[model samples]
Target: MEIPENYPKKYWHCHIEVDTGGKKNTSAIFNDLTIKELWQQVVSPWHTHRPFTVDGTIVRDYDKVQKIKITQTEHPQSYYAEQHNASMQRKGIADMATNRRLLPLSKGKDYTHEFLFADLTMNDNEQEKVVSNNKIFIVHGHDEQVKETTARFVEKLGLEAVILHEQANEGKTIIEKLEKHTDVGFSLVLLTPDDVGATVTDKENLKPRARQNVLLELGYMAGKLGRGKVCALKKGDVEIPSDLIGVLYVEIDAAGAWRLQVAKELKVAGLGVDLNNAI
Candidate 1:
């Protein structure tokens, strides 16, 4: 593999949190390195080690090193956050901690733990790679809370949430990756005011709108999966295209409230979701 030139302009700000129980944890590191390189350098070394047991939990740090969370900012949501904290990639029971019996062995307490590696890094390109998984493609602008909440909600429903910003696409562009990952069945677009657009003839009039990239993704989704398979959850003041009049853009002040409607739509699209029990 060709090594990426460490661009002087692109310095990654990272924050690592290492917890070994007893309420002790270390802060993340912010430096001039990509998420992939950090995994190979810092995380991999101390993430998991021998003995295979610590304070009732299985692996030391587990995937805390392997699966790095990518974002434009330090916040949790911004764009394609690591939705599924527990990666479906791990194969056997050795790596999968939740598969075995509960640790600490509390009858009524139900204490469970997994490596949540939320830190600095950028995957040039990423989405859920599982072809058989219930993949929900979440598209958004700069909102972090909505994206993070959406990812958690999707995982709560036992479905795979495919996030773009967390994957390493090495040499390809975002548009290229979208064309490649066509196995996705459903899409949730988050529209927030991040940009202002005015027509060429009417330069004086400016209105709240999503970023150009978000618009491009939305248009791509409409063409690739049809309007029925996509839902736009607009949070703030934003204007959309007139052609998308038939598309459903639900207005909401918050994020998690739209799960029921989104789940219902996913069910109709043949995802086998039970919205009745979901809250």
Candidate 2:
């Protein structure tokens, strides 16, 4: 028997997701009804397929699922070993498949769904573009002038600019306030030497760096939106953490030429930017 490249070679495989919040969970795919019905018989709380409508944005439980590829190829030996052990594995898979009310941890239920052989129009890259085309977050500490300068540029370019400062504090921790805007396509971290710190052992020498909030926000933005979408603008000789040694940065000198550099990053982050357009 010849297996054509386009042939639907069926096997029980799970589409495990690698989420931005550092969680790995599975969403299964059952090829035929017999398998789905068989699992229903064994699993305590069984799930029958629901009517799914395919629109431009996948509507799963009233949320949009952001599609991502299965980055891992190898599965645990338990998922492969069959017979007695297979029963537990199947049950575990079933539980994961149905235990879905909301995934609030990673920004709460991004119905941006995808799985192997699942019917959907767009791919992962297209989803990224569509989702990231909205806003850009600017993280700063005690540099209102700099923030105002940057915000003006972002607005003139025709995109929404977000600042952690504008968010309602309401006694919320700094992190909680910042993460509320995690859906932004990109982040700008202003590294102005606003705060000075001394080493524990030597209190004599002072170091110039951004505030602790700025540093923490930069690291968080790098992890969530990814390093490529996060930019560090240096207005002074701020200490660059070793982990962010290779991240992109634009030095702001008196010449004020950082505009073009920042614009380039915005263009990639989904803004329809014209580099020639003077900022």
Candidate 3:
């Protein structure tokens, strides 16, 4: 077999000889094989053919075996490669633990931990204390009327509305500011028809749409907070984004029916909302 130039220079060479009393020994030699590959290609097949007894019970259809012997020799290059790999694995694990401990609680959500460790353990009450449940992030576009009205309604529900631009810039970029403020438990996306666009082929047939920034923030909020915790308020003749098919979109009609819908969504998302206040 041709080996790639980057392949490990050393490997365990294995020789297996099986003697079933009736016949001559059957033997095979494999060169440049990893320990796992040696077991899978050679040892496992023999074990399957003649399974060892478990709890003094014989497996069905087991082959009668006399003697089976396996010999393995590790090349010097392979031994060094194994040692290097093991050391790197140990260092990687240590670095991951250190990084996890150094990351702030707000940024910890970005990392995925497969197993629970002592440093990462937190009770439900502790987690609730870290994340604010009463704050609602409002992702708005160019429509000041809709933005102000939505902010007012959110505040009227006895909850704090987090408006991005209203917060101090603090010498951070827009995305950085957004990341700092997205710790809220819920988000409200205002999809006002602030722009118009159409496919390249049908440039003349433009349709009203929300600003690109609004859609970008909408997606970001939906991902940060789950779709159930994010609600989109469509105002006027704005075209709904096709990608957000499963997300909840409430119509902001002139008669003010959207307030009740928003209040219901907030209540379902574990926010304290007074339905009567919405009406």
Candidate 4:
């Protein structure tokens, strides 16, 4: 069947049944149509078989579907799949959707009433592993004091601090290395003044800024792990990126108040943090 141009290209496995008096009901599976388009172009047309009786007493209309079981599959039809694949390839894997695996369909809990949908791609065990991640990526600049302090703080909370340079290169590029180590549940960005920069028209009026690589990794971490999972520790006076306005940044003060703030953020991000550890 030629799908409508406007309809979504998802493939659905639908189990439908048409009412027929005492005799056997007409049951069929339509595998190539989206639920919306299937209802409109196919099921709706069956309305002409109206006023049909089931079990010799109950009356029903074909349009008034008695039961609909729909399970969306992994890929669309070839034509739609090709189009989607081309678009995704152009955007690259970094921009691609999360990876998912389809599971075999199983019977629903109440076998008589409904069919159990496919199991979610990520099971409870996988989700628990992600949520229970104990490592925190540390995106730092040239400020050794700030970096060490932050790493120590994370360790105090019983969490591992993933410093990029400390990890094995294994012949991987910088970005590739970063990607490999981004399996952590949270990221701590150290924004320290390691460089000076100003607009093209104002060369002499340069201001303090974090290292270019530090800023790049900060953005990368923020994107990989959501903003809530990434926290920035601003040390001294550094030029903050305008694009990262909404990100949380705790100031590195002499009184060590930043530790408590960071610990709280970590707790909010679902990490196991003891606030007393910060003390």
Cα lDDT of all candidates, in order? Answer: 0.57, 0.56, 0.65, 0.67
lDDT of 2 at 93: 53
Candidate 3 per-residue lDDT over residues 35-151, each given as its tens digit: 456444433333223222222322222233322233333343345445555776888743333322111221212111211111434445435434567889999989899999999
Using alpha carbons, what is the TM-score of model 4? 0.59
Best of the two (1, 2) by TM-score: 2
Residue 254 shift from truth in candidate 1, angstroms: 3.6
TM-score (C-alpha) between model 3 and the true structure = 0.56
- After superposition, the stretches of candidate 3 with alpha carbons farther than 4 Å from their true spots are 1-131
C-alpha TM-scores of all predictions: 0.50, 0.57, 0.56, 0.59
The C-alpha stretches of model 1 lying farther than 4 A from their native spots are: 1-133, 200-202
Rank order (by lDDT, best first): 4, 3, 1, 2
**Best candidate, TM-score-wise?**
4
